[model samples]
Target: MKKHTIVALVQDRPGVLSRVIGLIRRRGFNIESLAVGHSETPGVSRMTIVIEWEDVEQVVKQLYRLIEVLKVSDVTDDPVVEREMTLIKIHAPGPKRPEIVALSEVFDAKIIDVGANTMVIEMTGSPAKVQNFIDVIRPYGIKEMMRTGRIAMVRGVRGHNAEEFVENANGHAERVPVMN
Candidate 1:
């Protein structure tokens, strides 16, 4: 099983996300991580889903079966830029504060908040880097942690443009202009 990154554009409407997730679940594919938010297009949303699967092309086709799915692309093989953000609150007593601060600085992370007993470290980088930071700080006893799952975009001029084309009722591709 290889990790694949799938990027999708869908209508910004209620239940769209649920339906998309349901379809993938019903197909027996496990989602490793998912990040979704509003897109450059006003009424559309972009989703970055990571899954470990053998047949990713089938999954892309399945996503297009949904009317709300405007576009789906398996960018795992493409040159892409990916990132994840994490905020970690660790046990930082007075004696250990300097060590923790030094570690954060080494990772290029920010000391977002500092309290008497704990400090919050914020880091944004590739998923592997973020995970490495967590592992390094784990010994300090993590008080709390929150991570925004991986978000990815294909490199260069080609991009997921929702307005480029959409499947019409007859299953034919039709050009659609972006709506602001």
Candidate 2:
């Protein structure tokens, strides 16, 4: 199977997320990472989804068919940028404090907080890079982890704007205006 990243714009209303997730589940596509946030438009949310699939084209078409989905694009085909944020808590004893601080500096991670025997670190980078950092600190005993998921956008062009979609006379397929 091949891995693909899909960026979708959808109505930012309640239950939209569940509907989108349900569609993926119904298709038996495993979502590796999903990030949802407000878009440039009000009442619209941009969702970045990463999944492993055998047929990406078919899945993208299906994703577009969802009612709440305003626009869907396979960002993997574009010169896009991606990033993920992670907060990790590690066991940092008095003796390990300096070592942990050095590791954090090496990885460009910030020490968010310091507890009696634990330190919280916040790191942001590409998924693989973040995983490498986690692996490097695994020996220190990770107590907890929280990730904000992956978010991406095309490098040059803004994707289809929701306001550009016009309902056809049949009210079925929305006509997307061409850009010149």
Candidate 3:
């Protein structure tokens, strides 16, 4: 199973995300990570999803079938920079606090919150780095942990222009222009 990252632009309406996730679930695609947020263009949203799939074309076609889906691009093969952020609250008191802070410095992570018994460390980097940091600090006893799904953008060339995404879908050009 190969991992694939797909970026999708969809109408910023209610129930859109749920429908996309439901479709993937129904198709038995293993979703590795999913992140959605408002895009530069108003009334449009960008979703970055990582899934384990052998047939990427099929997934793209299925996504295009949704009326709310404006554009879909398989960025997995593109030269893209991907990042994920994690916030981990670990047990750190007295001596342990210094040790945890020192370990975080190696990764350039910051101590966002400090308490008497725990401290929250924020780390942002590639998924591997974030996971490794968490693993190393696991022994310190994780009180709470949260991770934002990976977000990616291809290197070189603007992915969007004038609120328009021009891409060939199904042997024809699909130009989705988000209204201003």
Candidate 4:
């Protein structure tokens, strides 16, 4: 089995997420991670999903068959930009405060809040980069953690454009403007 990342653009309607998840579960696919949020367009939500699949092509076709799914693309093979967000709270002694701050700076993370004995750090980056930051800060004692799953978009000149996306689905080949 190979790992694949798919970005699904769907109508932001109630029960849509549950229906999509149900399909995946019925197919016996393992979802590694899933993140859903609003897109630049109102009433549209983008779902970023990572899963292990035996055949990516079949999965993509199956997803497209769903009525509510507006667009489905397997971005794992594409040259795309990907990122994740993580928040970590750590117990910091007075003397260790400066050290922790420096580490966060090195990782380009922000110190969101500082208490008398703890500091909350927010970091956004690729998964490996975030894991490296977490590994380095674990020695200082992590008190809590929260993470937003991975989100991605295709990169460069060949990225999907809104009109092109619609036309492609409609058996037309005209270029269309990209929608965020």
Leading candidate by lDDT: 1
Off by over 4 Å in 4: 161-180
Ranking the candidates on lDDT from highest down gives: 1, 3, 2, 4
Candidate 2: which stretches are off by over 4 Å? 158-180
TM-score of 2: 0.88
lDDT of 4 by residue, 1-180 (tens): 888889988767789899888888998877888999976655567899999987878777887888777778899989998899999999998999999999999999999999999999999999879989999999999999988888988998775433333334544333346577
Tell me how many residue pairs clash in candidate 4: 0
Worst 10 residues of 1 by lDDT: 166-175
TM-score top scorer: 1
Q: How many clashes (backbone atoms < 3 Å, residues ≥3 apart in a chain or on different chains) does model 3 have?
A: 0
Q: Per-residue alpha-carbon lDDT of model 3 for 1-180, expressed as tens digits?
A: 889999998877789999899889998877889999977766678999999999889989999999989888999888889999999989998888878989999998999988889899999999989999999999999999999999988788856322564334443225565676
lDDT of each: 0.89, 0.84, 0.86, 0.84
Please identify which of the two predictions, 1 or 2, would achieve the higher TM-score against the true structure: 1
Candidate 1, residue 157: Cα displacement in angstroms equals: 0.7
Greater-lDDT candidate between 1 and 4: 1
Name every residue pair that clashes in candidate 2: none
True-vs-predicted CA distance for residue 120, candidate 3, Å: 0.5
Q: Once model 4 is optimally superposed onto the true structure by TM-score, how far is the C-alpha of residue 164 displaced, in angstroms?
A: 6.5
Kindly report which residue stretches of model 3 are placed more than 4 angstroms away from their true locations once superposed. Answer: 158-162, 165-180
